[model samples]
Target chain A: MNPKNHTPLIFTLLGGLILLFIVSPLLGMFLATTPAQLFETSKDPEVVKSIWLTLWVSFAATMIFAIGAIPLSYFLARTKFRFKGIINGIVDLPIVIPHSAAGIAILGFVSRDSVLGKIGSSLGLNFVGHPAGIAIAMAFVSIPFLINAARDGFENVPVRLEKAALNLGASPIRVFFTISLPLAWKNVLSGLIMMFARGLSEFGAVIIIAYHPMITPILIFERFGAFGLKYARPVSVVFIVVCLVFFVLLRSLAKERKSHDA
Target chain B: MMLKLNNISIKLGDFQLKNIDLELERGDYYVLLGKSGVGKTVLLEIIAGLIKLDSGKIILNNIDITHEKIQKRKVGIVFQDYSVFPHLSVKQNIAYPLKGKKLTHQQIESLIHEYAELTNITHLLNRGTQKLSGGELQRVALARMLVTKPECLLLDEPLASLDVQLKGDLRNLLRKINQKGTTILHVTHDYEEAIALSNKVAVMHDGEIIQKGFTKEVFQKPANEFVANFTGIKNFFFAEFSPINIARINGKIEIHVSNHDQIKNGKIIIRGEEIIISENHIDSSATNNFKGKIIQIIPYFSNFELIVDIGIEISVVISEDSLFKFKFKENSEAWVSFKSSAIKIIP
Candidate 1:
């Protein structure tokens, strides 16, 4: 061990403390709930329904909003325009504001008295206490992760590569599809995963918007408040396990795609 | 003219290119030479339609392409860094521009192989670009651009990033490409590359084309002092001309120069290789001769640059054989001689 190596070791020790701080509580909860309890919670119809709703709603929000977000991110990366800094700040606003405040702001925009609410009412689609409202809240709170990641991905691509493609007689749109998008896909995938995971774990805004069709997070809170920690622990363990399996699966898929592209 | 830049001018925030004009004939290998940051690459980008021109018309093959889209301009450019797509195989990168041209898959494949063979990268066609050497990457970039069969090819400092042997090989390749009837505009700051690869040359300074002509003519007679210095002429002095073709340098020495347009005052340039050194005065057709002591001798490539104090320090390059034949050494007295026609007068 060299004297110069001591600083990195010290930093590693500090980092390990925070890592343990995060893992210990999750590990303790998993150990406290037995397999029998986890199986029972998984078999409960309400529990299963909430988990399904949570997964599908968040996935739907991520997929639907990504179409618009990806193009906006590309524009933000490549073009120069007035107030670009302000637009970038607005994109990151959702990540910094409190979730309850975000929910209130969304409610004010989509309430029955608002113009959009009136338009939805005309279409017989109620946003309050609806799955639509749940999706909107999840999208609002989690979209920043996707935008920032995709923007960074686009920024990392060398501008000269795109210029070379154009000089070789490819159209601008063709260059974007064949050159820019493929090079930046890895970061885009990571962003998609982050957005989906963040949306799945959302509770504050989703509860305010639509509590009838309970997501797993809201259900866990409800069970803890009513029947104490014992009842809530089983559901929490099941949810965490499911989320972990999906996260691992998505990350491996991203890695495989990256290697294949390379 | 196959291509012409008609009074092109562009402004790019704090740096501006002003009123640049150039013309190239068909099958011409033109070299644009300049120091770094003289807008050489920016000018190449404008020709390739990657940069917008604030004012000027770019006429290529008698068609105005000033407002044309890049894809429609029929021009290709190979950048200094190669910019080979990291996510694509060498073959796939070569085939990129051919994908949407309504060519059959077999046709595209055949074209890719043809260009790959031309650039001597046929073995590396299916390989990914991550681990290729710099020379291999350059070949890949060349094949990708050449496969498109562009009307004109623009190379931006193509040889600046290669080793000496690689530079020679690529210079030969560029010559072969030009001989096969592809017009090329190569941008480099290397005079050797300019002399080896281009029949015509243009020197750029401070965002303007200062001088352009046949390579031999431009090297022998530059338009100004900057061009003379840039072309590697080491002997320069301010001189006042008399009516009898005599130039007096700082009232120290007088040398005869070929008369030109009765110019009153001008700068005199002498190539180091044209000046000769001898142990004693020799009888010859040479007009100007002086006795001077050698002040310093700096070894150049296979030769020595002798700085002789003939009233004014003048640099002279001589072969090793000549150095020993004259018995030249530091602080040794010798006679220096040159013809009157050897001096270049830039007014």
Candidate 2:
């Protein structure tokens, strides 16, 4: 056999190891838990409520925060100013910090004695043990993904196109809506999906701020601590299957839109 | 004047354009010719209101619009890259500027078809912009800009990225557009494009307009050495002129020139194609003649360029037939001659 033929086999073997490492745990959990157990867990009121809360809260956080983040991303991508690099570094700071540390940081900012806590008090809103608090924690930790992705998208848009639109008698705002936003929408959509996914998987931050809201991650941690491995396994399997279905569906939708656009 | 730039000045980082003044009458096609990095695009952008001038006044159609916003300026520009919107179809790209004009749907459709047909991209209306050819993209960009009926059109090197055949086609399109009555200010580095496209030409050097006049006059009588060399005059020499119409070059060779009573010392330019070269002296009515040796022969397009050194190295271009008839070779003796009228004196 030619030595070159062996190269692909060698690469395949090496690549297969990492793929096995990622797939093995999920496969083991699914295989260990019977379908009856998964079905029973899906019917449980607590598990069903926790999963629904996790999905809706994370999605709401992504949609609400995106309003502010997208414009900030466009500003960062277009302008050159003093301390712009420092601002970009600050945006990425949450991703580098430990999740529990990010949780602690958010806790301090909204801990009833801070200025925001007082403002929330005046507005009849409490941060601790509330869905609003959980949404805030999710947004605080996952927003960098959206900002970075959208900024990259805006940077790839040619400034000359915007100028051309302006020369054709379109106002600046009109150019943004027609030219800049449409071209960058794919990246922006990808960013939103990533933020939502990251928010769904969040545990350390949500538990620290709003333990009573009982998102799926916190509930799984509680069941494992209380009833040991047997009880936690079924919930984990159900959550994984739900997440996989959502991820695959969202990605397929994105791909279908891309093909349609092309 | 349809448009005028009065003492326009702008500074961006290390580059600055200083005191640029230009005027364009109605229905005139003007070409701003310069080499790369001479601030030609910057000037075009400033005129279109895409860039703000640090100090200047812009007057269009007898109104001062020095600080008007870009959308209200009524000036359109087509960039060299032909920035057609990739997300829109060719028809949609052309229809983008017509969205807020309050026109009826039928009116907008008719206008899009009209300009698209004018630019010869009518067949590409429904197709997406990604797979279009360079010429097609250029036509789309022109259609997009022309659909709005702007007062002036600014083209930044419109023909720079095109192949030879595409460039010729687009040149004809631009000429037709100009004839239908739109003032155009075109920027290009190719002198041939200026010669073929514009009635008025200006040469820019290092952020300033060095010379501007009618196309024929500017090419024939450039203001200085830089303009002369840029406009393709191959032979230049600094000389001193006496009262007898005799100019001495480098204190070595004396050449007879046309009489200029006021020019006592100046530079003289002789076109390379005007000089006659032969193996022996021929009896002719030419006023200047010299016996020289051919030092170099370079292939220039279809003709051969010979550098003959009599007292100075003078370049002469000869046809292939002459090259063979004289059997010109390196280190061969030849006679070069030209009339007095062929020498242009610039002081």
Candidate 3:
């Protein structure tokens, strides 16, 4: 080997340690849970319901917000207007703010006396102390991942492609849907997956928003606080396993779609 | 006129175009020839309504389209990178513009098939654009653009990234496209491409149109030194011309000119092919003849390019037959002559 390749042994060792530091805890947690305990936790009605609710509601939130977020990202990517930086900063503000603070901030706007709360009540829906509240909290905290990813994807798409579409006599709206959206579909899908995953893992925000109808994270905290470490271990392991399965499934779907599109 | 740009001016980033005016009659092949960064692509974009112009009036077929939207302008553009939609198959991409035009499915398919056959991309109809070579991509882009039947076509270096053989093929393809009644405005930096593919040509430099005219006229009598140099004329001198049309070059060589209506000490140009070479001085009607030693002889394709020292280095092109007859080599003396009409003043 060359001397240049020989000089960086320390860097590789340190990097390997960091990688181990991230992987060891997950591996240990998975190893600690017995199969019987995992089966018992999975059979519990409350735990199963909470896990199902968490996955579906987070998926629902991601799907709902993407309708607006994807278009907003495409607009941000393609246009140059005044205060664009300010708009970008506003998009990123949710990620930077503490999640608990984000939860509290959302509560102020959706409480019973607020305008959104009154509108929801008028329509026989309540945002506070409801699953809708949990969905909102999860979406609020995780949407920046979707927006930033989609924006970057749009930026990578060549402007000439869009121009070529317009030159072909397609309207601006048609160009966005057919050309821009499809070209950036992989990034948008990845963003959706990230947002969905982030929403699934939300704790500080979702717990504060709707603690009564518990998500998996809140259920894990409640079981640990009330019972003991053994009771929460199997639930945590099961949730991680479920999340891992869905994450891998979605990622492979994205890869498959990308190859098909290509 | 099919398309006319009246006093178009635009400033994009650091490049500025000032008072660019051009006109194209119906079925004309116009080439915008310039070096890179001379705003050729920007001008094409402006005419296509892709870029907003600061001050201009575009009249296409006697209708003002200066402020029209790109799609509504009835103009199409093919980019240098082809810009074929990667997410769609070739057939889908070709039929993209006809989607909402209320055409029947059969009509769209037949039209796609027709254009595909026209551009010789019929075999690649179902293939993904990502798997295409540069030439195939260019043909697909042409098929997509031509399928719309736009009034005018703007090509921004469409053949720039292709190989020489592919360029020759696309050149014939563009001619065929033009023959079918589409006015073409092709932008390139190549002199030979301009001369070969266009009947009319415009030369741009530093964001301004330096000269625009018939291609043969522009090549023979460039309006300025830049145009002359851009048109591949290599022999140049900054000489002083007297009132009687005698030019003294480099404070040494004096040559008689046909026109000296202006001041002295300006630039003059002559093409290398215009210079005649002989071993001995003979009577000729040409105005200027100089006896010079050959400094270098470089073989250029089927001809030999001799760089001779006539006080200053002057390039002269000679055929293989003439080279064999003259038997001129490095350090050999020869007489070079050029007509007065061949000398062009950069005014």
Candidate 4:
């Protein structure tokens, strides 16, 4: 090997940049609040309720995405059809739009002036200031991550495998469950984690949709406005910790899946 | 015949399987010979009911199974990739088709053991099927098919991905599979495989089975120019019967034609096997002998494919021993021979 080979230097530079970019803000968040302060804020009754609502709604939204998007993603990946490009573009539109813009668009559908909102109110159910609103907002912006990841996973499955399964006396549905789904499960799982994380951090969309019953992000925002950074930083620290733990567990799972596949 | 196809047709975006008619006798091996993109695999899938026909009927044991679902069709498929389930063990993969059946666990286990033994992969039962080599994977795949006891096995380039030694071994394995009362509809673009494995061969071109017959009939008399060329028939050139049978370009050589069955307005064919490469025109034994210079010398396994540049480039295949003895090489002078009877004068 050449002593002057540039690979290690290049890799070190890239690795250092990514480490600094991700770690610095997270470190700041952690350092901003002491463990004593984090524990003290956990006793705030309002803060506890908002965080509970946020986690549950985000979890529900993520579960719904898993249930619906996996099959539909496989379809988009495997099918050869006219207007597939248009359909794919439509699926990815939420990701391309800013979260605030996505919220504004959702507002157009569920505002009191809109037909759906009128029908909802007539039925004695309201999207505004409800868990349903939070779920919808989380789902709208984050659904594409799960769908696209799952789609790419399904795409990597050779069509010949399906044909082989069919030839081996399995139906099309049987083939999907047995071969296609299992092979693509890792990518789908990673997508689910990413989508869940995306949903957890959804501030712009959820705030615009349902501002009163403040989610964790909205609570942090409210705390900052009402009680200043001293009150908000502790909750932010706890929220970051929860998000970090969830992600770390998921990251390990994803890593295990990658190694298993390899 | 266990399976018979009548004018089966299916069209993918660019490729079409047009008017393919085939008959597969009980335990018969029929190889679909074609170029890479000539819809050979598509036709096999259509027959297996994985692909719906544009306009056709597939008859299996006299039941019109044109609209049958793939699982209901009882066709086993081994793709070029073998398509073994990566997650499933060898036993599980082989025993996959038996999952929803009425067979007991022990029965399925014993069946897997039996087929595994037949394919000589019994030792790999607990290992994942993906860990097996190409030949091993194919054997397992074939064994998986065998357990289902399919009406016919559809193999698309079964040994195309294997090494030369493995391909030969797998070919033998495939031959053994065909012997075990299973009909095979094997597809390959390789002429040697088609010749070796198939009792009947279908030469496809541009999505159509242009010529199909018993292996010898199709090889001896290809129906058209495309089939002739595709199968290494090595026969070509313009000729007329009225002019005492002279090739269009070679005025120095003359040939006699009985013209028993003249086809109208087409180039005549002289099969490579029929063309004889000799040292000289020793007159007393054979006719249609002529002097020529070798243009190309291609070693074709058991023989040498000597191209005689007699104005029209007549390619003659001779034994390797003869090539070594005479040293008939590239750009060397040589004598060529063929009987007028062997000159397939296209009518």
Candidate 5:
């Protein structure tokens, strides 16, 4: 029986290998930065401002995803639509497309000449070299995480609940808010958490649009390019720490939302 | 009270509802009876305003609500699966419709309690509905639907998923609801259920209502062969017209018929379970008696249905008590007798 546990043994080996692969870089970042240098860099105002900007921008993007992405995801989940398979494929396109390509596509549309950008500019909003640019970049790469997550959550919900509400003389919209949203809230929350975390780590796209906003990822890149990995190491370690806390919280939430077999 | 559907036609995939016309008066418990994929549930949904009909007019209470949205229609529906919300507890689920109304928490609670006690699931008020058994969930679902007190209620096979034993109790509960002027449009495919509960039955096949009338009338005198076959009327045959009312099976054999109501394009129905069989001809004045050979004896619980050949194979069902009393073996000669009233004309 002990020897027969090869499946679990194989699983353990695979998990251990993946953990090493993810943790080794963070370990190297910490090793590259001495304690004095890490403490010295942490005192800098530029570092603090960049961290706050990254945190707040990610939070704003997550809120936006919650407002817009949730309804779309729920619609995709609940309805038997003609283009549902295609719609889902399109939502997932951002995840698979090269992040640089995604950055270029978003840049082309929000470049003040396109209809959407023109409207935004008329409303005294500009995407170029502003927080809006970083927001758009983060949104482009990370909204798929939120939509797919919320969609999966809505899909997990039993549609009978919606029907029950309607048959009880409640309106369709009433049923959606009262039953569907609350039931699938945890899934959406996890999506938001992941999208926020993904937004925090975004670098490739943000560089194309708003490098001066100096999101934490850009700061990490700038420091490494100008000074060395030694200077960049401390910032990388700090970003890693902030992201780890959120990652743990997301994992816990996912666990909480999972159905127990009973 | 007056619910009328005028020429309702809807195409859903291959099964299309050609033109269904039905009316349910106040205090009428109408059950839509049909086989699978006959558009019975779809019809219920259309009436409830859940599904938009391709073309039709649904006039409820003299209101032309053909274009009304689902919420504005004010009709309640209990889907075939009961479709209870798993997230909301019984109390909350029952209170779902009451929300956004002028009712307070206490008022909602009282309504929930009132409907809950009526459905006899008051003890399940606080439990998550996902854990409920099919019967309990159905009661909660019913309680929720009744709490709203919509103009008309549509039920789609509330007993289909329950075990055979539970159907009787659920059916009786449903009958009591029907008795209270709910004007239920119940949908079911089961024949016995329609016989047991329906004041009016609309027979649907391949998405069209072939026959609709008083329950017993439709069962006793089917309008067509399809309906006759549907309602378990087993003794069906066609014979050419004769000068006398004797349907001649052969040169020497003929069966007597007197009821002209039993003639329709020269086709008639005799229920398999209604005909009686005996070894020697009985002295009773049963209108039709014929000498026949038993082709098969099919056992059905406490009785056996015997198929006999008197030129044409005619089935006669006999009780097991009669099976023992008459010592007739299979392939033996027997005389089959039935009354004229038992024969029904099928258009």
Candidate 6:
């Protein structure tokens, strides 16, 4: 064999180690559990409700906050305002900060005595131990993913395209919608998917805000802490499978749209 | 409509536009000619309402549009790179500006088709702009701008990105567009393109309008040394002027200087194309004749530049047929004649 052929072999061996590193834990957990255990966990109403709550709250948070987050992202991408670097750093702050600290921060703001809590109380609503609180926690932690990705997308949109649209007598708002947004759709889509996925996986913040609604991660933690790994492992296997299915489905749909566009 | 810019001034980064005053009559094609980074595009953008001016007045068709929003200003601009929207099909891109207008869907569709045909992009109407070639993208961008029927059209180096053949075609298209009575402002660094497409020309240097007049006047009689050099007036000599029309060049050649006003010493500029080359000495009404040897023969587009050593080196542009007729080459002896009227004295 040619000496160059060894390069591919060496790289493949090195890359396969990472692929196995990612795949091994899940595979081992899946193989360790019997089908009967997985079925039983799936049948448990609390587990079913917890997983459903996780998916539903994550999706709601992504859809609801995207309306505001995407526009903020476009503003960040398009202009260099005073303190722009600081504002961009603030956008990424949630990712670097400890999740428990982030949870504590949210707890202080939406707690019963905080300004938002008072407003919520006046409206006969509460953020503590409620699904609304859970949604807020999920959105707070995951919105950075959407904003940063969408900002990158908007930055990639050529400024000349917007200028050309303006010269053609189209208003600025119309140019944003018809030219910038459509061109940056792929980045926007990926950001939304990431936000949805990150929101679904949030545990520390949601556990702090609302413990009773029991999003799937909190449930898994509870099962492991109280009843040990035997009960928690089966639920974990089922939840992971469900998430993988949805992620794959969403990604495939995005890929289909991309190919269709091309 | 006639457009006038009075006292336009702005400072952007290292470039500054200082008190630029220019006017364009209705239906005139004016080229803003300058070197790169000389604020040519900035001037065009200011006129198009893309760039806000610090202090200026823009009067178009008797209406002051100094502070008008870009969309309300009846001006269209074709950018240098032809920024066509990549996600939209050519037809959709051209029809984008017509959405808010009172036109019906059929009217918009018909207008798109009309401009698509006019710009020779009818075949590419259904294709996304990303899939089109460079020339195709340029035509689509032009059609998109023209479909709105803007009152004043601004082109920023529209032909710079094209091959020579495509540049010629687009030039003809621009001419046809100008003939339909739209006031056009074109910015280009290429003087050939400027001279080819302009009735009036404005030369900018370091963000100021150095000279502005009819194309013939600006090219024939440059206002200063920069204009002379920029317009390719290659023959320049330091000379002293005595009483009457006599002037001595390099203390060697003496010639009759026309139109000497004041000051005794200045630069004399002679355009290369005005210098007549001949085989032998010939008597004529010309003021200066020199017998010199060819130092260099540079072949340019459709012409040859003979740099002749006449005390000082003087470049003369001549046709290829004349090169063969005189058998001109390096070290070939030739006679050069130019009138005093052709010697534009800059003091």
Instruction: Give me the candidate number with maximum lDDT.
Output: 2
lDDT tens digits by residue: candidate 1, A27-86: 999999999998899999999999999999999999999999999999999999999999
Q: Better model by lDDT, 3 or 4?
A: 3
Q: Where does model 2 sit among the CAPRI classes?
A: medium
lDDT of 1 at B126: 89
Candidate 4 per-residue lDDT over residues A1-262, each given as its tens digit: 7867988998999999999998898788788778889888888888788778877898899997678889889999998899999989998999888899899888888877889889988988788787887898999999999999999999998887887787787778899999999888888888999899999999998889999788999999988999998888989888877888888998898899778766
A1-262 per-residue lDDT for model 2 (tens digits): 7889999889999999989999999898889999899889999999999999999999999999999999999999999999999999999998999999999999998879988888988999888888888999999999999999999999999998998888888988899889888888889889999999999999999899999979999999999999998999999988878887888888888888889889
After TM-score superposition, the amount by which residue A217's alpha carbon in candidate 1 deviates from its true location, in angstroms, is: 0.8
Better of 2 and 4 by lDDT: 2
TM-score of each: 0.87, 0.86, 0.89, 0.81, 0.82, 0.89
Candidate whose TM-score is highest: 3
Ranking by lDDT: 2, 1, 3, 6, 4, 5
Question: Candidate 2: DockQ?
Answer: 0.73
**Compared with the true structure, what per-residue lDDT tens digits does model 2 show for residues B253-302?**
99999866668898999988899998889889898999999999987435
Among these predicted structures, which one has the highest DockQ? 3
Tell me the spans in candidate 1 whose CA falls farther than 4 Å from its real position: A1-20, A107-130, A259-262, B239-266, B272-283, B287-337
Report the CAPRI category for model 4.
medium
lDDT value, residue B61 of candidate 4: 93
- Give DockQ: model 6: 0.75
lDDT per residue for candidate 5 within A1-262, as digits (tens), equals: 7777798889999999999999898788788778887777678889889988998898898897678899999889878978889999999998998888888888898989988789889999988778878888898899999999899989988876676676676777788798888888777878888899989999888888888979989999999999987778898887777778878977886676665311
Candidate 4 Cα errors over 4 Å, as ranges:
A1-26, A39-53, A79-137, A204-215, B11-15, B123-133, B235-249, B255-284, B288-342
For model 2 chain B, give the 10-residue run with minimal summed lDDT: B297-306
Q: What's the lDDT of the predicted structure labeled candidate 5?
A: 0.83
List clashing residue pairs in candidate 1: none
As a TM-score, model 6 comes out at 0.89
Clashing pairs in 2: none
Query: What order do candidates take by TM-score, descending?
Result: 3, 6, 1, 2, 5, 4
**CAPRI-style grade of the A/B interface in model 1:** medium
